[model samples]
Target chain A: MRRSRTALFVLVLALAVAACGGTASLKGAVRNPPLEVGTLSLPGPDGREVTMKAEPGGLLLVYFGYTSCPDVCPTTMADISEALTELHPDQAEKVTVAMVTVDPERDTLERLDDYLGHFFSRRLPLRTEDFDRLSAVTAAFGVQWEIEEHEPGDQAYDVAHTALTYVVDDTGTVRVEWPFGFSSEDMAADLAALLEEPRA
Target chain B: MKRTSCRRRLAIASVLVVTLAACGGGSGGLEVTEAWARTSPAMAEAGAAYMQITNGGGADDALVGVSVDPAVARSAEIHETVMAEADDEATHGSDMGGGMMEMRAVDRLEIPAGETVSLEPGGYHIMLLDLASPLEEGSTVELTLTFENAGELVVTAEVRATGP
Candidate 1:
């Protein structure tokens, strides 16, 4: 009886280790206490207010950027699209990408749709002119951004914004955060691993 | 008269040598390589190009100006992306609050002797403004870079979906 009990204890220990080790090897920065997605209802390209949600066992890739951004935004969008291509078609279908434009003044609904659709077909274009609501949503995700003051007709103005990408779990909690310069291969690997993790 | 002719021939030969050096012949000179630009999305008014400029000669050089055809873009300017701290003080203590990236126009980019200067993403780049059309993938755009010493060099940048 003693030996049997010891064997059972060892088996239980192994199972626990397997469960915890799954996400510990992720390439992104894992959030200890993940932040909630929090009330991000914005207008999609179709002129309808859409509330962002994460389905169980699925992933949400959120990025903050604008259409006028030439360098960082395009590189990031391409990387995400490439990462999705690296995943299995079924796994890729389980993921959703949403880009929230910090510069709504320049990023109209039609403009955002055209820019984002070129990179990934499975994407959501989130834009809002209500600065107060935008601030609340960005604050929840710990994103920071600023736009240069310019005249109404000034097309050369610039916007200063963060480049961090967030990975939200099925619960709408930010599970991992990837900073600027993260490679597409690493992102794909993280997505595969996150998909395998069991939802709580 | 024969001796004078010989001397004049030598003078002409020396002048040829000087002209050869100035034209970047055998002597090491500026070389631009690996020039590429990311494909611009449809309706995007601006785009950026990146490359490495190597000053192989003994004297330093500076890239003072850049130009592209009006069909490609209205103008090209050298710019640098800088990281600025976010204004949200609430997230100040957290490392996840990555700072904001800002791009500013730079007047000159110096290429020191025997050094290679790279213009890459999140760093120095050539900002193409008022693009007449979207830079399509697999297409090429021509740019003329004016250097203080190396004169003007025409570089063709291949457009791709991502950076190299």
Candidate 2:
């Protein structure tokens, strides 16, 4: 009886180890005691104060960009759109993408709505002219951005920022950070895996 | 007098040959391929175009300017997206938020000899400013690329729903 019990314990230990190892294969890092970022209150596309929190039992993907961003911003949005398209209809419905504009001076609410409408219709386009408020929100999520002024005669400037997509769990905790350049298939897989996890 | 006239004719012929060579007239020239553009969002006033440029000749080339149809866009310019350097530590946290990203207009993009320069997303691209109309998916736009030595190369960029 003693030998049988020891064998059973060893089998149980092995299974536990295997289960833990499964999460290691995930494309995005799994946060332990996930990062606590509070709710975001900003101006929505309608120029009204809107509060954004992770869905009660869903996922929120947040990105920082501008309407005039010619390359990376659009590319990342396209990737997210493709990822949602690849998911099951029910699964896709649980995901929401909220894009906050770093260039609020030019990215008006109407401009943002027109820009985001290209990739997905369900996105939350937020903007603010207050830099301090924008700074606080970015600090919470560890996002970075800066503006590059053009020459005296030039009509445009550039805003350099971190190109990362933060995946927030339903409980308003950042669960994963998707870097730029990830494929749509990889993004979809990560989202699916996170959705399967029980809310913490 | 006859000898001097013959020398003058030779000088003129040499200048013509040099001009032709500089204009990418021979077997060695610049080639552009795999041109494409993403479909603009509804009501968007701007769009972007991407392509790969290859220099087959021995001489170096520079993409000086780009032009689109007046009906398609009001103006077009070259732009590059770059990551912000992580040097500042005062305003932003060292671990979470420091690197800021931005894009700026570029006057020229150089293509070295026997090398290929790709204008893909998250890198170099053409910014179509003030679009006359939204870019429809499955459509094509005509673009003319002007180079310092290769003159002009025209291409039809397909507007895709997404990107390549």
Candidate 3:
């Protein structure tokens, strides 16, 4: 299975390169059987419980990280922000970004809001201490997170988590998944194509 | 003499452009270049700074400590983002480079003689904790870096929205 996936990835990479930024070619990894993530009721901005759903004819981006992360999380957010700017105004407006905090103990809803507001104006800060709900969501998205045990008063405990971003299309299906270190230009191009091109 | 002077001038210019830092002092100790920090939002409690530290001296050096100006942040520590080894079964067949990643404080970053060590995103970095104020774009923050051999050297890291 690993070998086959690797082969497919290489083939896709070759095709992407050959196409040379052609329309309908996505830079991210395309989910063969697109993941269906229907509406989820979670705590959203302004302390409101909102139904998390992709807008019709739009896209939804979901990420998992903590605000205290000084390195990777902020970098990814900045890249996403940059990518959105690269998109056409119409396409950009149709996108929604939602972030789930893996370190709920340290990441208050207010902190998440503040951190996400820096990059994008339209942001959803999802945080819940309920392990069952969080686990269900993360497991469905194939995200894993582990918080190191530390003293109760210690605020320096670190969290280990998956660094993948999922892109949900208008149909509430995860069409593509971007890995860590995905460039903003490529992301922007993929997003544009996802919005403009008809799915094969 | 004219040829030697011209060659020296060319070398200096190259150093300026490539290193983005002043030429090494008489001893050619260490040069910190391309130092910058990403701008933080108003309520951001933490930030990070990145740079390339080149040891031009014959002796090796180590970046042992870091501290931000109190006005910029309450404290600073050298950190490294490491990909935690995940259960093979969990990450298997995932093409998204999906894995567990973590960050931890790094005690020392060694720079061998004539070697450049980079403190960059997704790698070694200077983690700023309890940011006193938002690192505004187009602004600069002063950082005091202490090395095993170079003692303490101050560098102004320009605030940017992204990596340099």
Q: Quote each prediction's TM-score.
A: 0.87, 0.82, 0.82
What lDDT score is found at residue A146 in candidate 2?
Answer: 71
Q: What would the C-alpha RMSD of candidate 2 be, to one decimal place?
A: 7.6
The residue-by-residue lDDT of candidate 3 on B34-122, one tens digit each, is 99999897777889999999998898889887767678888898999998876554332232446778888888889999999999888
User: How do all the candidates rank in terms of lDDT, highest first?
Assistant: 1, 3, 2
lDDT of 2 by residue, B1-164 (tens): 11236776575456446645666565337878888988887766668999999999898989887878879988788888776675564233233633555667788899999999999888898988878888888889998776776666677999986766
Cα shift from native, residue B44, model 3 (Å): 1.7
Ten contiguous residues minimizing lDDT sum, candidate 1 chain A = A32-41
- Which lDDT tens digits does candidate 2 get at residues A1-200? 99999999999997885656345556975666556765767787556776556677788888888876767888899999999999988889889888998877777877787787778767788888888888878877788777555566553555677888888766577777787878889899988877775443
The DockQ-based CAPRI class assigned to model 2 is acceptable
User: Cα deviation of B8 in candidate 2 (Å)?
Assistant: 30
Pairs of residues at least 3 apart in sequence or in different chains that clash in candidate 2: A159-B101, A159-B102, A160-B100, A160-B101, A160-B102, A161-B100, A161-B101
Candidate 3, residue B64: the lDDT equals 84
Model 1 achieves a DockQ score of: 0.33
lDDT of 3 by residue, A1-200 (tens): 99999999999997785554243378898765667776655677677875556788788899989988888998999999999999999999988889999888988898898889999988889998886777677777788887777899898777788888888876667878888889999999888887885434
DockQ of 3: 0.28
Specify the poorest-scoring 10-residue window by lDDT in model 2 chain A: A147-156
